[model samples]
Target: MRFLFIVQGEGRGHMTQAIAFYHLLRSQGHEVCGIIVGKSKRREIPDFFSREIKAPIHLVDSPNFVADKKQKKILLGKTIRKNALMAPTFWKSLKTIHQVVESRNPDVILNFYDLLGGLYNFLFRPNSRFWVIGHQYLIHHPEFIFAKGKPWDKFLFQLNTHLTALGAVQVLALSFLPKNDLINSKFRVVPPLLRKEVRKLEVKTEDFFLAYMVNPGYGEEVLAFAKSNPLVKIKAYWDKKSAKPIEYPLPNLSFHRVNDQTFLQDMAACKGLACTAGFESVCEAMYLSKPVLMIPVAGQYEQACNALDGEASGAGIASNSFDFSLLEKAEKKDTKVSFQFHQWVDSWPNILSELIVSAEQESGVKNPDGEFDSSPVFG
Candidate 1:
């Protein structure tokens, strides 16, 4: 079978998911014909992704949305305005994507939350089956846990769901939340899709904590924490947008630009993680038996929920600020989330493979795997 994937390029998470899925499909004897990446001006596609991926990659102008730094708010107006300005370009990119898909004639199209995929599905209406795969799809599930906040926040959350639901035939939601949270939804709650590197790694807990954050303001706070902790060595990664790598030698601190292998290696070697409460990284850390010190980005609800859930699962501790006391407390706590995670990871591959097969079959494509040939939708 042939597969085409459209990935959102807003962050490394989606790209990592794509890479993992690509390997899984190839391992199952399927060919990935093409990869369409939605590019954001603010982000450059990492060198590792370009060099590591096996299939042909194409860039497209797709809508990119981000949260505001100070308040951790969505900045809906700004997001809509920016994405609206790209409408013409997005449409043109859709034409290019359609042409590529038509030429490739993939048996299935898997989208990693790229708005361009929604646009493509809206325009061409391809006969090939389509599946939307990502952690973001969890937002649409009715049982999805909502952050404690204002009513307007809830409204905005609903709006986000409506926009993301456009043109998706199937939604795969990744969450640590209970199965009840995923019940009665059009989507399926699957285990977080971890990268093969993370899945295969052997974790060792060393002295230093591994920290990474993409947002600038919160990153500064993390740096501040490292500066004060002279006894504890800290290794961090950030996109500082500087031509030269900035090194702040505080006797116990180090920083590097985003490097996949280095980051994974650091995670494996670290005692724990001290970073923003992003789902992908948190999942990776938990899988590696590393406790996390989760600093929820100031106004982002998703990160807030992630922090709460992380704490609830005993995977990590949550803090509104980079409090040294909280960090100490988390460090002193026994890191036992490892035992709970193995079962989750063991079940995920089968869940994802089955979903992909079902989506393909629904679109009239034959499934090569008899084990997953039936259209089974498990909650």
Candidate 2:
């Protein structure tokens, strides 16, 4: 079968999921015809993704969040206004997606929660079967628990999630813990799409703590922590394009650019991880058995939900600020939970293979050539 991946190019999480899925499809003797990633001017596609995925990537202008001056909180109002003004550009992007889909004509189109991908399917209604993938889809699960308060935030987040699933026939909801599939509603609970490299890592517990901030704005908080605790070493990574290869704001504090290999190595070696509540990294830390401190980006309800879910799954403690002290003072984390989570993650291969076939059969879409397409998604 031929597959085409449409990924949202916002943060590292979705792109990493796409990379894992790319390798999985190839290993199953299926072809990935092409990849269309929705991008914005705020960020660039990481070098590791292009180098690792080994596929032709198409970048299209799409809606994205607007951050405040500190680059911390998500400015929902401003974000809507900005994307609303870019309606014409987004329309062009939808057309671009259609053209790519028509040209490649894959057997299955998988979207990693890219709004443009869903919008494209809604407007064009292509013949290829479409499926959506994300942890966000788990929000509707009866067993899922949401963060306290923020009713409005949850509603908006769910609205965006729905928009991204407009024409999807299957919703693959990635979860930290196994749950019964919502078959009646086209939702399947699946394991996290962890990359092969993660499994190959030699885990270790080093002296320093590691941190990853989706927005560099939180670096200030990390710096403040480092300043107060001068003896404790800290290694932080951020998406600051203008930053140096390695920045040392203080003798014991250092910041590095977001590099896939380096970040994984750090996660394996660090005593604990303090990062914004993005799903992938927390899962990585759990698989590596490293305690985590998740501080959700303000106004990002999805992340707030992630922090809550992660804590319940025993990833680590949740905090509203970058307080390393909490992690240090907190009681020992549960190793049993980590063991269970690792087992859950290790089941991805068998589970995903079976689910993909089920999804194709459920959609009733045959391969374009009456057989699996042998041609590669990229040359």
Candidate 3:
């Protein structure tokens, strides 16, 4: 079967999920027709994705709903304002995307949380089946549990979910937590998608701590904590303006950009982690049996809930702020959760294939189950 994958190129998480799905499909003897990546001026496509993903990549200008740094929150007003301004560009991109999809005539169209997917469904009305797949899609399910917070904040999250769900044939919500009220609506619960590389990497418990802050605001706080502790070797990944392999005055601290090979290598060697409570990173850390100190970005509800869930599951400690004392205490004790992630990893490919087949059949697309039903190609 030929599949067209639409991805939101906001962070490493979406791209990683795409990479995982791409490999899984190919391994199952299905062909990925092409990839449509939403491009943001603020972010550059990482080298890792370009080099690793074999499919042809096309860029389209899409709406980006980003956090407001000044307010230190996700300003729905600002998000709407910015997205409104980009409407023309978005329309143009949509036209191009529709042409690409029509040319490919794919068996199914899979979306990796691209807002453009909603727009694509709105504009193109393709005869091909469309399925939305991502962790963010969990928000749309009625079974998802929302952390108690300001009413407006909660409303905005719901609004975000609703917007993403517009015209989606099926929504796949990925989570490590149990399904709840928010997740049970309009979506099927799926396990977190992890890359084959991550699954294959050997886990080793070393003395060093792994730290990553994709947000620059938290870089100084983490660096200070790392610097204060001379006894602990800190291999931190920072998103600051700096050269690679930047050695700090502190003997045991070092920082690098998003170097996949180095990051995975360090993760394998780290005893534990001190990082922001991002879903993918935390999942990877837990898979490697590394306890984490989850310092969520202030005013980011998702990260806050992630931190709370991580703590609840005994995977890590949650800190209201980045504190060296907290890190010191967490380091002395072990809080790794013993979970069978291998089961999820092994089942993902089959699950994804089944979903694509189901969606295609519903849309009356020919070759609905694609190559999977015809023969056994992958071991």
lDDT top scorer: 2
Q: lDDT tens string, model 3, 109-161?
A: 88887877766775677766666776666655554556675577667666655
Ranking by TM-score: 2, 1, 3
Looking at candidate 3, what is the lDDT of residue 40?
71
lDDT for model 2, please: 0.86
Per-model CA lDDT versus the true structure: 0.72, 0.86, 0.71
User: Any residue pairs clashing in model 1, and if so which?
Assistant: 71-299, 72-299
Better of 2 and 3 by lDDT: 2
Q: Which pairs clash in the backbone of model 2? A: 32-377, 33-377
Q: Candidate 1 — which residues are off by over 4 angstroms?
A: 66-74, 177-186, 243-246, 331-337, 360-379
lDDT of 2 at 77: 90
lDDT of 3 at 323: 61
Residue 355 C-alpha lDDT in model 2:
69
* Cα RMSD to the true fold for all candidates: 4.6, 4.6, 5.7
Give per-residue CA lDDT, model 2, range 1-379, as digits (tens): 8889999999999999999999988888888889999886777789998998877799999889999999888998999899999999999898888889989998788999988877787778788877889999898789888887888887888888888888676788999889998645466888998898999999887888999999999999999999999989899999987888799999999999999999999889988999999999998888888889999999888998999999888778999999988777655447787678778888777876886677556555447768632221111
State model 3's lDDT: 0.71
Model 2 poorest 10 in a row by lDDT: 370-379
